[model samples]
Target: MNGQVNARAGASGKAGEKVLIADDEPNIVVSLEFMMKREGFHVLVARDGLGALEAIRREHPRLVLLDATMPGMTGFDVCEAVRSDVDTRDTRIVMLTAKGRETDKARGVGAGADAYVTKPFSTRDLVQTVKEMMARDAAE
Candidate 1:
Protein backbone atom coordinates (compact mmCIF):
# COMPACT_ATOMS: atom_id res chain seq x y z
CA MET A 1 0.00 0.00 0.00
CA ASN A 2 1.46 3.34 -1.17
CA GLY A 3 0.54 5.31 1.97
CA GLN A 4 -3.09 5.26 0.89
CA VAL A 5 -5.89 4.39 3.27
CA ASN A 6 -7.25 0.86 3.49
CA ALA A 7 -10.28 -0.30 5.42
CA ARG A 8 -10.44 -3.96 6.26
CA ALA A 9 -13.56 -6.06 5.77
CA GLY A 10 -16.16 -6.35 8.51
CA ALA A 11 -16.04 -7.34 12.19
CA SER A 12 -12.65 -7.44 13.94
CA GLY A 13 -10.27 -5.04 12.24
CA LYS A 14 -10.13 -1.51 13.59
CA ALA A 15 -10.47 -0.10 10.13
CA GLY A 16 -12.03 3.35 9.93
CA GLU A 17 -11.64 4.05 13.60
CA LYS A 18 -10.97 7.72 14.27
CA VAL A 19 -7.70 8.78 15.92
CA LEU A 20 -6.61 12.37 16.40
CA ILE A 21 -2.90 13.13 16.79
CA ALA A 22 -2.18 16.49 18.39
CA ASP A 23 1.41 17.63 18.20
CA ASP A 24 3.40 20.64 17.08
CA GLU A 25 6.33 18.87 15.48
CA PRO A 26 5.85 18.36 11.78
CA ASN A 27 8.06 15.29 11.62
CA ILE A 28 6.23 13.63 14.47
CA VAL A 29 2.81 14.46 13.07
CA VAL A 30 3.69 13.28 9.59
CA SER A 31 5.13 9.99 10.77
CA LEU A 32 2.32 9.35 13.22
CA GLU A 33 -0.26 10.16 10.56
CA PHE A 34 1.30 7.74 8.14
CA MET A 35 1.59 4.96 10.68
CA MET A 36 -1.94 5.40 11.97
CA LYS A 37 -3.46 5.62 8.50
CA ARG A 38 -1.65 2.44 7.60
CA GLU A 39 -3.39 0.79 10.52
CA GLY A 40 -6.72 1.67 8.91
CA PHE A 41 -7.67 4.44 11.32
CA HIS A 42 -9.18 7.67 10.06
CA VAL A 43 -6.56 10.25 11.07
CA LEU A 44 -6.98 13.83 12.25
CA VAL A 45 -4.15 16.26 12.99
CA ALA A 46 -3.91 19.34 15.19
CA ARG A 47 -0.68 21.29 15.57
CA ASP A 48 -1.48 23.02 18.79
CA GLY A 49 -3.38 22.53 22.01
CA LEU A 50 -6.41 24.66 21.23
CA GLY A 51 -6.74 23.16 17.77
CA ALA A 52 -6.53 19.78 19.43
CA LEU A 53 -9.46 20.63 21.66
CA GLU A 54 -11.48 21.87 18.72
CA ALA A 55 -10.69 18.74 16.72
CA ILE A 56 -11.74 16.64 19.67
CA ARG A 57 -15.09 18.37 19.82
CA ARG A 58 -15.70 18.43 16.10
CA GLU A 59 -14.20 15.10 15.08
CA HIS A 60 -15.14 13.06 18.15
CA PRO A 61 -12.30 10.64 17.50
CA ARG A 62 -12.24 7.29 19.30
CA LEU A 63 -8.69 7.95 20.45
CA VAL A 64 -6.31 10.90 20.76
CA LEU A 65 -2.50 10.95 20.89
CA LEU A 66 -1.97 14.16 22.79
CA ASP A 67 1.25 16.12 23.19
CA ALA A 68 1.77 17.79 26.56
CA THR A 69 3.54 20.83 25.20
CA MET A 70 2.14 22.67 22.24
CA PRO A 71 1.38 26.25 21.24
CA GLY A 72 -1.72 26.89 23.25
CA MET A 73 -3.83 24.87 25.79
CA THR A 74 -1.31 22.05 26.45
CA GLY A 75 -2.20 18.35 26.51
CA PHE A 76 -3.06 18.47 30.19
CA ASP A 77 -5.59 21.19 29.55
CA VAL A 78 -7.09 19.32 26.64
CA CYS A 79 -7.25 16.12 28.63
CA GLU A 80 -8.84 17.92 31.54
CA ALA A 81 -11.36 19.50 29.23
CA VAL A 82 -12.27 16.16 27.70
CA ARG A 83 -12.51 14.53 31.09
CA SER A 84 -14.78 17.24 32.38
CA ASP A 85 -17.17 17.23 29.48
CA VAL A 86 -19.75 14.53 29.96
CA ASP A 87 -20.30 14.09 26.24
CA THR A 88 -16.58 13.71 25.59
CA ARG A 89 -15.45 12.20 28.85
CA ASP A 90 -15.41 8.73 27.40
CA THR A 91 -13.00 9.57 24.63
CA ARG A 92 -9.62 7.83 25.05
CA ILE A 93 -6.46 9.90 25.42
CA VAL A 94 -2.80 8.87 25.25
CA MET A 95 -0.41 11.56 26.45
CA LEU A 96 2.58 11.53 24.12
CA THR A 97 5.43 13.81 25.08
CA ALA A 98 9.15 14.21 25.67
CA LYS A 99 8.51 14.86 29.32
CA GLY A 100 9.17 11.46 30.84
CA ARG A 101 9.41 12.44 34.48
CA GLU A 102 7.36 10.56 37.02
CA THR A 103 5.49 13.71 37.95
CA ASP A 104 4.69 14.39 34.33
CA LYS A 105 3.28 10.91 33.95
CA ALA A 106 1.32 11.37 37.13
CA ARG A 107 -0.13 14.63 35.88
CA GLY A 108 -1.12 13.09 32.60
CA VAL A 109 -2.93 10.33 34.42
CA GLY A 110 -4.38 12.83 36.87
CA ALA A 111 -5.90 14.68 33.93
CA GLY A 112 -7.65 11.49 32.85
CA ALA A 113 -5.32 10.29 30.14
CA ASP A 114 -5.70 6.55 29.41
CA ALA A 115 -2.02 6.03 28.66
CA TYR A 116 1.32 7.81 28.39
CA VAL A 117 4.06 7.27 25.83
CA THR A 118 7.35 9.09 25.89
CA LYS A 119 9.06 10.44 22.80
CA PRO A 120 11.25 8.14 20.69
CA PHE A 121 8.76 5.41 21.45
CA SER A 122 8.33 2.26 19.43
CA THR A 123 5.74 2.60 16.67
CA ARG A 124 4.98 -1.10 16.88
CA ASP A 125 4.31 -0.83 20.61
CA LEU A 126 2.16 2.20 20.11
CA VAL A 127 0.05 0.55 17.44
CA GLN A 128 -0.35 -2.62 19.47
CA THR A 129 -1.23 -0.66 22.60
CA VAL A 130 -3.76 1.35 20.69
CA LYS A 131 -5.41 -1.82 19.43
CA GLU A 132 -5.59 -3.20 22.93
CA MET A 133 -6.98 0.06 24.22
CA MET A 134 -9.68 0.15 21.58
CA ALA A 135 -10.78 -3.28 22.70
CA ARG A 136 -11.35 -2.05 26.26
CA ASP A 137 -14.35 -0.09 27.48
CA ALA A 138 -13.86 3.60 26.87
CA ALA A 139 -15.38 4.55 30.18
CA GLU A 140 -12.87 2.42 32.02
Candidate 2:
Protein backbone atom coordinates (compact mmCIF):
# COMPACT_ATOMS: atom_id res chain seq x y z
CA MET A 1 0.00 0.00 0.00
CA ASN A 2 1.29 3.42 -0.89
CA GLY A 3 -0.59 5.61 1.55
CA GLN A 4 -3.65 3.82 2.74
CA VAL A 5 -5.41 5.78 5.47
CA ASN A 6 -6.80 3.74 8.34
CA ALA A 7 -10.45 3.22 7.46
CA ARG A 8 -11.75 3.52 11.00
CA ALA A 9 -10.02 6.81 11.65
CA GLY A 10 -10.82 8.09 8.17
CA ALA A 11 -14.52 7.85 8.81
CA SER A 12 -14.27 9.24 12.33
CA GLY A 13 -14.08 12.82 10.93
CA LYS A 14 -11.63 13.95 13.60
CA ALA A 15 -8.40 12.17 12.86
CA GLY A 16 -5.64 14.20 14.41
CA GLU A 17 -2.06 14.66 13.21
CA LYS A 18 -0.79 12.32 10.54
CA VAL A 19 1.67 9.55 11.30
CA LEU A 20 2.93 7.15 8.69
CA ILE A 21 3.71 3.55 9.66
CA ALA A 22 5.99 1.94 7.10
CA ASP A 23 6.49 -1.74 7.78
CA ASP A 24 6.16 -4.95 5.79
CA GLU A 25 4.91 -7.00 8.72
CA PRO A 26 1.13 -7.19 8.88
CA ASN A 27 1.01 -7.74 12.64
CA ILE A 28 3.33 -4.88 13.36
CA VAL A 29 1.38 -2.55 11.11
CA VAL A 30 -1.91 -3.47 12.74
CA SER A 31 -0.59 -3.04 16.27
CA LEU A 32 1.15 0.23 15.56
CA GLU A 33 -1.88 1.57 13.71
CA PHE A 34 -4.02 0.77 16.75
CA MET A 35 -1.59 2.43 19.11
CA MET A 36 -1.18 5.57 17.03
CA LYS A 37 -4.88 5.88 16.39
CA ARG A 38 -5.50 5.56 20.10
CA GLU A 39 -3.08 8.42 20.54
CA GLY A 40 -5.34 10.41 18.15
CA PHE A 41 -3.11 10.40 15.12
CA HIS A 42 -4.46 9.94 11.61
CA VAL A 43 -2.53 6.80 10.73
CA LEU A 44 -1.21 6.05 7.24
CA VAL A 45 0.25 2.68 6.23
CA ALA A 46 3.01 1.90 3.76
CA ARG A 47 4.35 -1.58 3.12
CA ASP A 48 7.81 -0.73 1.84
CA GLY A 49 10.46 1.95 1.73
CA LEU A 50 9.45 3.32 -1.67
CA GLY A 51 5.82 3.51 -0.66
CA ALA A 52 6.81 5.21 2.56
CA LEU A 53 8.81 7.78 0.66
CA GLU A 54 5.95 8.40 -1.74
CA ALA A 55 3.51 8.77 1.12
CA ILE A 56 5.82 11.14 2.94
CA ARG A 57 6.00 13.36 -0.10
CA ARG A 58 2.37 13.03 -1.06
CA GLU A 59 0.74 13.08 2.35
CA HIS A 60 3.31 15.08 4.34
CA PRO A 61 2.68 13.25 7.60
CA ARG A 62 3.98 14.77 10.82
CA LEU A 63 6.19 11.74 11.43
CA VAL A 64 7.12 8.39 9.95
CA LEU A 65 7.80 5.08 11.69
CA LEU A 66 10.15 3.47 9.21
CA ASP A 67 11.35 -0.11 8.95
CA ALA A 68 14.88 -1.00 7.97
CA THR A 69 14.25 -4.21 6.04
CA MET A 70 11.78 -4.24 3.15
CA PRO A 71 11.46 -5.41 -0.44
CA GLY A 72 12.50 -2.51 -2.66
CA MET A 73 14.44 -0.13 -0.45
CA THR A 74 15.87 -0.19 3.04
CA GLY A 75 14.79 2.33 5.66
CA PHE A 76 18.29 3.76 5.66
CA ASP A 77 18.02 4.43 1.96
CA VAL A 78 14.58 5.99 2.39
CA CYS A 79 15.80 8.14 5.25
CA GLU A 80 18.66 9.37 3.13
CA ALA A 81 16.28 10.12 0.30
CA VAL A 82 13.95 12.07 2.53
CA ARG A 83 16.79 14.03 4.05
CA SER A 84 18.18 14.81 0.65
CA ASP A 85 14.91 16.01 -0.78
CA VAL A 86 14.40 19.71 -0.27
CA ASP A 87 10.63 19.46 0.01
CA THR A 88 10.60 16.66 2.57
CA ARG A 89 13.89 17.41 4.30
CA ASP A 90 12.32 18.38 7.58
CA THR A 91 10.04 15.35 7.87
CA ARG A 92 10.73 13.50 11.14
CA ILE A 93 11.69 9.86 10.76
CA VAL A 94 12.08 7.19 13.40
CA MET A 95 13.85 4.06 12.24
CA LEU A 96 12.38 0.88 13.76
CA THR A 97 14.42 -2.18 12.92
CA ALA A 98 15.69 -5.58 14.04
CA LYS A 99 19.28 -4.52 13.28
CA GLY A 100 20.45 -3.58 16.74
CA ARG A 101 24.19 -3.51 16.20
CA GLU A 102 26.04 -0.36 17.17
CA THR A 103 27.14 0.14 13.60
CA ASP A 104 23.60 -0.29 12.40
CA LYS A 105 22.41 2.33 14.85
CA ALA A 106 25.23 4.59 13.80
CA ARG A 107 24.35 4.06 10.18
CA GLY A 108 20.74 4.92 10.85
CA VAL A 109 21.72 8.11 12.60
CA GLY A 110 24.25 8.87 9.90
CA ALA A 111 21.51 8.50 7.32
CA GLY A 112 19.63 11.32 9.11
CA ALA A 113 17.01 9.44 11.07
CA ASP A 114 15.69 11.59 13.92
CA ALA A 115 15.67 8.48 16.11
CA TYR A 116 16.53 4.78 15.83
CA VAL A 117 14.53 2.13 17.65
CA THR A 118 15.28 -1.56 17.76
CA LYS A 119 12.65 -4.25 17.43
CA PRO A 120 11.25 -6.18 20.39
CA PHE A 121 10.59 -2.65 21.50
CA SER A 122 8.27 -1.54 24.23
CA THR A 123 5.02 -0.16 22.88
CA ARG A 124 4.65 2.26 25.77
CA ASP A 125 8.15 3.58 25.34
CA LEU A 126 7.67 3.91 21.62
CA VAL A 127 4.48 5.89 22.12
CA GLN A 128 6.18 8.10 24.64
CA THR A 129 9.06 8.64 22.25
CA VAL A 130 6.71 9.53 19.44
CA LYS A 131 4.84 11.99 21.64
CA GLU A 132 8.05 13.59 22.77
CA MET A 133 9.34 13.86 19.25
CA MET A 134 6.11 15.40 18.01
CA ALA A 135 6.03 17.79 20.93
CA ARG A 136 9.55 18.85 20.20
CA ASP A 137 8.73 19.32 16.56
CA ALA A 138 5.76 21.47 17.44
CA ALA A 139 7.79 23.57 19.85
CA GLU A 140 10.32 24.34 17.16
Candidate 3:
Protein backbone atom coordinates (compact mmCIF):
# COMPACT_ATOMS: atom_id res chain seq x y z
CA MET A 1 0.00 0.00 0.00
CA ASN A 2 3.01 2.29 -0.20
CA GLY A 3 4.38 1.82 -3.69
CA GLN A 4 3.62 3.51 -6.99
CA VAL A 5 3.08 2.09 -10.47
CA ASN A 6 2.98 4.30 -13.51
CA ALA A 7 0.27 2.74 -15.59
CA ARG A 8 1.13 2.86 -19.28
CA ALA A 9 -1.38 5.59 -20.05
CA GLY A 10 -0.17 7.68 -17.12
CA ALA A 11 -2.78 6.41 -14.70
CA SER A 12 -1.91 5.71 -11.08
CA GLY A 13 -3.65 3.87 -8.27
CA LYS A 14 -4.83 5.59 -5.13
CA ALA A 15 -2.42 4.64 -2.41
CA GLY A 16 -3.69 2.51 0.52
CA GLU A 17 -6.78 1.30 -1.29
CA LYS A 18 -7.78 -2.33 -0.85
CA VAL A 19 -8.51 -4.17 -4.08
CA LEU A 20 -9.70 -7.69 -4.69
CA ILE A 21 -9.06 -9.43 -7.98
CA ALA A 22 -11.10 -12.57 -8.56
CA ASP A 23 -10.22 -14.82 -11.46
CA ASP A 24 -10.20 -18.54 -12.11
CA GLU A 25 -7.05 -18.21 -14.16
CA PRO A 26 -3.93 -18.36 -12.05
CA ASN A 27 -1.88 -16.24 -14.37
CA ILE A 28 -4.45 -13.45 -14.55
CA VAL A 29 -4.82 -13.44 -10.80
CA VAL A 30 -1.07 -13.36 -10.25
CA SER A 31 -0.55 -10.67 -12.83
CA LEU A 32 -3.31 -8.41 -11.51
CA GLU A 33 -2.19 -9.02 -7.94
CA PHE A 34 1.29 -7.87 -8.79
CA MET A 35 0.15 -4.91 -10.80
CA MET A 36 -2.23 -3.62 -8.16
CA LYS A 37 0.26 -4.15 -5.40
CA ARG A 38 2.91 -2.29 -7.33
CA GLU A 39 0.44 0.57 -7.67
CA GLY A 40 0.39 0.94 -3.88
CA PHE A 41 -2.86 -0.87 -3.15
CA HIS A 42 -3.28 -3.74 -0.76
CA VAL A 43 -4.38 -6.68 -2.90
CA LEU A 44 -6.41 -9.78 -2.13
CA VAL A 45 -7.06 -12.51 -4.67
CA ALA A 46 -9.62 -15.28 -5.03
CA ARG A 47 -9.60 -18.08 -7.56
CA ASP A 48 -13.36 -18.44 -7.91
CA GLY A 49 -16.57 -16.61 -7.26
CA LEU A 50 -17.25 -18.29 -3.92
CA GLY A 51 -13.81 -17.52 -2.74
CA ALA A 52 -14.32 -14.02 -4.01
CA LEU A 53 -17.39 -13.59 -1.88
CA GLU A 54 -15.66 -14.99 1.15
CA ALA A 55 -12.71 -12.72 0.65
CA ILE A 56 -14.98 -9.73 0.28
CA ARG A 57 -16.78 -10.64 3.45
CA ARG A 58 -13.57 -11.06 5.38
CA GLU A 59 -11.54 -8.25 3.90
CA HIS A 60 -14.22 -5.76 2.90
CA PRO A 61 -11.95 -4.60 0.12
CA ARG A 62 -12.65 -1.12 -1.16
CA LEU A 63 -12.98 -2.45 -4.67
CA VAL A 64 -13.34 -5.73 -6.54
CA LEU A 65 -12.17 -6.69 -10.03
CA LEU A 66 -14.29 -9.73 -10.77
CA ASP A 67 -13.98 -12.20 -13.60
CA ALA A 68 -17.23 -12.90 -15.44
CA THR A 69 -16.97 -16.66 -15.57
CA MET A 70 -15.98 -18.89 -12.69
CA PRO A 71 -17.06 -22.02 -10.86
CA GLY A 72 -19.55 -22.09 -7.96
CA MET A 73 -20.93 -18.67 -8.86
CA THR A 74 -20.60 -16.53 -11.91
CA GLY A 75 -19.41 -12.98 -11.51
CA PHE A 76 -22.90 -11.82 -12.43
CA ASP A 77 -24.31 -13.77 -9.56
CA VAL A 78 -21.64 -12.41 -7.30
CA CYS A 79 -22.45 -8.91 -8.39
CA GLU A 80 -26.13 -9.39 -7.77
CA ALA A 81 -25.49 -10.88 -4.36
CA VAL A 82 -23.16 -8.13 -3.41
CA ARG A 83 -25.58 -5.49 -4.53
CA SER A 84 -28.28 -7.10 -2.51
CA ASP A 85 -26.20 -7.21 0.61
CA VAL A 86 -26.57 -4.16 2.80
CA ASP A 87 -23.04 -4.25 4.09
CA THR A 88 -21.35 -4.47 0.68
CA ARG A 89 -24.00 -2.98 -1.59
CA ASP A 90 -22.02 0.21 -2.01
CA THR A 91 -18.66 -1.44 -2.61
CA ARG A 92 -17.16 -0.71 -5.99
CA ILE A 93 -17.19 -3.60 -8.49
CA VAL A 94 -15.66 -3.84 -11.91
CA MET A 95 -16.32 -6.86 -14.10
CA LEU A 96 -13.45 -8.20 -16.20
CA THR A 97 -14.20 -10.72 -18.90
CA ALA A 98 -13.36 -11.90 -22.39
CA LYS A 99 -16.98 -11.76 -23.42
CA GLY A 100 -17.46 -8.43 -25.10
CA ARG A 101 -20.97 -8.82 -26.37
CA GLU A 102 -23.31 -5.94 -25.73
CA THR A 103 -25.55 -8.31 -23.86
CA ASP A 104 -22.69 -9.25 -21.58
CA LYS A 105 -22.12 -5.64 -20.69
CA ALA A 106 -25.81 -5.22 -20.08
CA ARG A 107 -25.82 -8.28 -17.86
CA GLY A 108 -22.95 -6.96 -15.80
CA VAL A 109 -24.55 -3.59 -15.43
CA GLY A 110 -27.86 -5.13 -14.56
CA ALA A 111 -26.10 -7.12 -11.89
CA GLY A 112 -24.91 -3.86 -10.37
CA ALA A 113 -21.31 -3.69 -11.50
CA ASP A 114 -19.97 -0.16 -11.31
CA ALA A 115 -17.64 -0.72 -14.24
CA TYR A 116 -16.62 -3.23 -16.93
CA VAL A 117 -13.41 -4.05 -18.77
CA THR A 118 -12.94 -6.62 -21.47
CA LYS A 119 -10.12 -9.10 -21.42
CA PRO A 120 -6.92 -8.71 -23.39
CA PHE A 121 -7.26 -5.23 -21.97
CA SER A 122 -4.51 -2.69 -21.75
CA THR A 123 -2.88 -2.55 -18.33
CA ARG A 124 -3.34 1.17 -18.50
CA ASP A 125 -7.05 0.78 -19.02
CA LEU A 126 -7.39 -1.51 -16.05
CA VAL A 127 -5.44 0.73 -13.76
CA GLN A 128 -7.27 3.78 -14.95
CA THR A 129 -10.61 2.09 -14.52
CA VAL A 130 -9.66 1.06 -10.99
CA LYS A 131 -8.47 4.51 -10.14
CA GLU A 132 -11.59 6.12 -11.49
CA MET A 133 -13.83 3.75 -9.59
CA MET A 134 -11.86 4.38 -6.43
CA ALA A 135 -12.24 8.09 -6.90
CA ARG A 136 -15.97 7.76 -7.42
CA ASP A 137 -16.27 5.61 -4.34
CA ALA A 138 -14.50 8.26 -2.32
CA ALA A 139 -16.83 10.95 -3.60
CA GLU A 140 -19.83 8.92 -2.50
Candidate 4:
Protein backbone atom coordinates (compact mmCIF):
# COMPACT_ATOMS: atom_id res chain seq x y z
CA MET A 1 0.00 0.00 0.00
CA ASN A 2 3.01 2.26 -0.54
CA GLY A 3 3.36 2.32 3.25
CA GLN A 4 1.09 5.35 3.55
CA VAL A 5 -1.34 3.33 5.56
CA ASN A 6 -3.32 5.51 7.92
CA ALA A 7 -3.87 3.31 10.90
CA ARG A 8 -5.48 6.13 12.81
CA ALA A 9 -9.03 4.96 12.17
CA GLY A 10 -8.49 1.64 13.87
CA ALA A 11 -5.05 1.24 15.29
CA SER A 12 -3.76 -2.31 15.45
CA GLY A 13 -0.81 -2.27 17.82
CA LYS A 14 0.61 -1.62 21.28
CA ALA A 15 -2.65 -0.56 22.86
CA GLY A 16 -3.41 1.41 19.70
CA GLU A 17 -0.93 4.13 20.54
CA LYS A 18 -0.17 6.22 17.47
CA VAL A 19 3.16 7.39 16.06
CA LEU A 20 3.12 10.10 13.42
CA ILE A 21 5.76 10.22 10.69
CA ALA A 22 6.21 13.82 9.59
CA ASP A 23 8.57 13.87 6.66
CA ASP A 24 8.47 15.23 3.13
CA GLU A 25 10.75 12.57 1.71
CA PRO A 26 8.65 9.74 0.33
CA ASN A 27 11.35 7.12 0.79
CA ILE A 28 12.02 8.11 4.36
CA VAL A 29 8.34 8.20 5.16
CA VAL A 30 7.76 4.80 3.63
CA SER A 31 10.63 3.15 5.49
CA LEU A 32 9.90 4.84 8.78
CA GLU A 33 6.20 4.00 8.57
CA PHE A 34 7.04 0.40 7.84
CA MET A 35 9.51 0.20 10.68
CA MET A 36 7.16 1.80 13.16
CA LYS A 37 4.40 -0.52 12.15
CA ARG A 38 6.72 -3.50 12.57
CA GLU A 39 7.59 -2.21 16.01
CA GLY A 40 3.90 -2.43 16.90
CA PHE A 41 2.94 1.19 16.62
CA HIS A 42 -0.12 2.56 14.86
CA VAL A 43 1.22 4.83 12.16
CA LEU A 44 0.15 8.16 10.67
CA VAL A 45 1.82 10.12 7.90
CA ALA A 46 2.15 13.86 7.19
CA ARG A 47 4.04 15.32 4.29
CA ASP A 48 4.44 18.76 5.83
CA GLY A 49 4.70 20.54 9.13
CA LEU A 50 1.12 21.81 9.03
CA GLY A 51 -0.30 18.36 8.43
CA ALA A 52 1.85 17.02 11.22
CA LEU A 53 0.54 19.58 13.64
CA GLU A 54 -3.00 18.84 12.58
CA ALA A 55 -2.49 15.13 13.05
CA ILE A 56 -0.84 15.74 16.38
CA ARG A 57 -3.92 17.58 17.52
CA ARG A 58 -6.51 15.32 15.96
CA GLU A 59 -4.99 11.87 16.42
CA HIS A 60 -3.00 12.84 19.50
CA PRO A 61 -0.22 10.48 18.56
CA ARG A 62 1.89 9.43 21.51
CA LEU A 63 5.04 10.32 19.63
CA VAL A 64 6.00 12.17 16.47
CA LEU A 65 9.07 11.63 14.29
CA LEU A 66 9.40 15.12 12.84
CA ASP A 67 11.56 16.50 10.07
CA ALA A 68 13.21 19.84 10.64
CA THR A 69 12.67 21.13 7.14
CA MET A 70 9.18 21.00 5.72
CA PRO A 71 6.87 23.08 3.58
CA GLY A 72 4.18 25.38 5.01
CA MET A 73 6.01 25.39 8.37
CA THR A 74 9.31 24.22 9.77
CA GLY A 75 9.51 21.37 12.23
CA PHE A 76 10.81 23.76 14.85
CA ASP A 77 7.70 25.83 14.40
CA VAL A 78 5.48 22.77 14.67
CA CYS A 79 7.32 21.64 17.80
CA GLU A 80 6.93 25.06 19.38
CA ALA A 81 3.22 25.13 18.56
CA VAL A 82 2.68 21.70 19.98
CA ARG A 83 4.53 22.65 23.13
CA SER A 84 2.50 25.78 23.53
CA ASP A 85 -0.80 24.03 23.19
CA VAL A 86 -2.05 22.56 26.44
CA ASP A 87 -3.78 19.62 24.80
CA THR A 88 -0.83 18.54 22.63
CA ARG A 89 2.00 19.79 24.78
CA ASP A 90 2.80 16.39 26.22
CA THR A 91 3.20 14.73 22.84
CA ARG A 92 6.72 13.34 22.54
CA ILE A 93 8.60 14.82 19.61
CA VAL A 94 11.80 13.47 18.10
CA MET A 95 13.35 15.75 15.51
CA LEU A 96 14.65 13.69 12.60
CA THR A 97 16.64 15.94 10.37
CA ALA A 98 19.64 16.05 8.11
CA LYS A 99 20.81 19.19 9.83
CA GLY A 100 23.21 17.79 12.40
CA ARG A 101 24.95 20.98 13.36
CA GLU A 102 25.24 21.71 17.06
CA THR A 103 23.23 24.85 16.62
CA ASP A 104 20.49 22.96 14.82
CA LYS A 105 20.28 20.43 17.60
CA ALA A 106 20.12 23.18 20.15
CA ARG A 107 17.38 24.88 18.22
CA GLY A 108 15.34 21.70 18.00
CA VAL A 109 15.58 21.08 21.72
CA GLY A 110 14.95 24.71 22.35
CA ALA A 111 11.81 24.40 20.27
CA GLY A 112 10.64 21.64 22.63
CA ALA A 113 11.60 18.45 20.87
CA ASP A 114 11.94 15.59 23.33
CA ALA A 115 14.80 14.19 21.26
CA TYR A 116 16.74 15.07 18.11
CA VAL A 117 17.99 12.46 15.66
CA THR A 118 20.15 13.28 12.72
CA LYS A 119 19.68 11.74 9.29
CA PRO A 120 21.55 8.60 8.20
CA PHE A 121 20.58 7.25 11.60
CA SER A 122 20.55 3.53 12.17
CA THR A 123 17.05 2.09 12.05
CA ARG A 124 17.72 -0.03 15.13
CA ASP A 125 18.81 2.96 17.13
CA LEU A 126 15.82 5.01 16.01
CA VAL A 127 13.42 2.23 16.90
CA GLN A 128 15.11 1.82 20.28
CA THR A 129 14.84 5.52 20.95
CA VAL A 130 11.15 5.54 20.01
CA LYS A 131 10.49 2.58 22.25
CA GLU A 132 12.32 4.13 25.15
CA MET A 133 10.46 7.40 24.79
CA MET A 134 7.10 5.67 24.47
CA ALA A 135 7.88 3.46 27.43
CA ARG A 136 8.85 6.44 29.51
CA ASP A 137 5.58 8.08 28.60
CA ALA A 138 3.72 5.00 29.62
CA ALA A 139 5.53 4.95 32.93
CA GLU A 140 4.53 8.49 33.63
TM-score for each candidate, following the candidate numbering: 0.86, 0.91, 0.86, 0.91
Better of 1 and 3 by lDDT: 1
- Once all C-alphas are superposed, what RMSD does model 4 give against the true structure? 3.3
lDDT of 2 at 57: 87
lDDT of 3 by residue, 80-117 (tens): 99999998887789999999999999999999999888
lDDT of 1 by residue, 1-140 (tens): 11122222223325337888888888997888778877777787888888888878876788999999988688999999999998889898999999999999999999999999999898889988887898775536
Of 2 and 3, the candidate ranking higher by lDDT: 2
lDDT of candidate 3 vs native? 0.81
State the displacement of the C-alpha of residue 101, model 4, in Å, after optimal TM-score superposition. Answer: 0.8
CA shift at 102, candidate 4, in angstroms? 0.7
TM-score of candidate 4 versus the correct structure, residues matched by position: 0.91
Better of 1 and 4 by TM-score: 4
**Model 3 misses residue 129 by how many Å?**
1.1
Model 4 C-alpha lDDT per residue in residues 1-140, reported as the tens digit of each score: 22232554323475547899999999998889888888778888988888888888888889999999998889999999999999999999999999999999999999999999999898789999999998888788
> Model 1's lDDT to the true fold?
0.82
Residue pairs with clashing backbones, model 4: none
Q: Write the per-residue lDDT of candidate 2 for residues 1-140, one digit (tens) a residue.
A: 54443333533424336889999999999899888888888788889888888888888888899999986889999999999999999888999999999999999999999999999898889989999998998799
Query: Which 10-residue window in model 4 sums to the lowest lDDT?
Result: 1-10
